[model samples]
Target: MEWLQPTSENLIEGYDEPQGKLDIDRVESKQITTNTIISDFFVMLNCLGERTVSQLPAPDDKVYHRIMEEIAPYFERILIIKINNQIIEVSLQHVKKEALTILNNKAVHPVLDEFFHGEADKSGYNLFGQVPNRSVYKVLPHFIDPLEDPEVQQLFDFLKEMCSVTKDFGFILKPWLLSDELKQLQAIRFAAHYCQDVYLWVDNDTERIFEIQFKF
Candidate 1:
């Protein structure tokens, strides 16, 4: 084992020791097994969409049972991580589509378009209710501006009502702000009063205040 450590002088020459033999067949089998496990886990997650507290398949289910048993408690954690990644990807796509629609109808700043099209943070929670919190909302600068016009005020009021209704059930909101001024104000206001911790950012390109909500 000590001889396997390559020194700087011999590093470029490669290992001096003879190549150790490996069981290629066994390695291939393990690789296949790992792929199968991951594939099955994804399938399970897809089946669990929108439904809370899914019942695991019986231990007699062979393939699924074997995978879960092998992974044990870590299986749930991996499943959740994969699910969250999938949700974030889907949620971002949904947001881009909606933003594009909004842009087509109204003249929006180029910077705002770019900001919306670019990467967004994936940080929110799922709230349960009749409407359900499928969309993630980001509190934009317009949301907290005290001098907002009537139209802007109405939009904020609508958002506040939505937030209030979903407070008990819980919802996810991200804040993409152009300054810390609005972000700090909104965070304390929304979180303390409505129990929402909206994600915040400072970007001049960001225009609308909204959230990225997702399903499943």
Candidate 2:
């Protein structure tokens, strides 16, 4: 983390650890698998109905059954970590593929590209999430009480069992400006629309008010 003078783009002025660079693949291209995450912008690899046994590499039945009686069901995906001398990541797959395309193509964004696997957080060494309707939780939340849903409760137990195997693992999302502090900021304001260009309406608007929109 470092601090500097605020710019039009970054009003907050300071940043947290410039995010974790835990993998060379993420650095080169913010993609773990070459598969498509699709429009939902959710679900790690789009394994909508796939089970852990199908998605994960084969392990001993004794090891697998101990984790979950029949087979462990993921919220959608799992973070498989195998820790040795240093952390080793094993799971991060995007399940969906573009079937309509004549050419193999994929799409990504703030949503689909977003993976909250907190590999950097000590508590989140093996990231697990059950995000419903886009709500988020801490890297790790205490599951002290029994959940109402039997399947969900089972999933929680499954997550705990997975954590016991500390040897192996793995899994981000990104953002830019959100606010500004200047008094005149709101008075004379223009902000980008998400992934949309700030100067998008510049050439079209009669008032030309969008001229002040961000350029760089």
Candidate 3:
């Protein structure tokens, strides 16, 4: 999924806080519902808000594509899903060592949390960059395309507002988790390309999320 900015130049329409976020329980089902997806996204945005998060401030075509290209090669771990399911501890072992050494751990963990545990660190590193308060970074446009349902749109609005209340600047590692079909684990390696503090995520498919152990 393209994490499109909610900028006027990009179709010009649309789109946080460090506070307690909403948590909805997962209802077991092989086929995920739209509401479930919406809730998962809401939690992701709220997680971004609760910390000093970073996102791409609507990057121009060149930078976005280049960064994506650079990120493409980082995902090489063949996650035998059925096999990995039994492992209790989830680590960045799946992520390439060089990327982790380059971008460092801070830039990648949040994205990992979203993909694996379906949560974020409410109390992780608070080191923010030199972004001025109320800069363009604070404005996060909707990442996904406009949906057809009014209820879903309203929920999305709630997500937009959630980010508005936080100290979020454009420095996040975007993972294309808009659908279950996307290779989400591979997609999240997008974090490895950047060497700064970044935060990002999208609606999840609720793949029976497991417990996540904190490194810090």
Worst 10 residues of 1 by lDDT: 87-96
* CA lDDT, every model vs. true structure: 0.28, 0.26, 0.28
Candidate 1, position 10, lDDT: 17
- Each candidate structure's TM-score, on Cα atoms with residue i matched to residue i, is 0.23, 0.23, 0.19
By the lDDT metric, which is better: model 2 or model 3? 3
lDDT of 3 at 208: 19
The per-prediction CA RMSD against the true structure, in angstroms, equals 21.7, 18.1, 19.5
**Per-residue accuracy of model 1 over 1-216 as CA lDDT, tens digit each:** 111111222111222322343221101112122222223222322222234332222212343344343322222222311222221100000112222233356553322222233233343312222232122234333344333234333323333432232322222223343334433342333333332333321222343223332111
Model 1 lDDT, residue 21, Cα: 36
TM-score head-to-head 1 vs 3, winner: 1
- Estimate candidate 3's alpha-carbon lDDT, on a 0 to 1 scale: 0.28
Candidate number achieving the greatest lDDT relative to the actual structure: 1
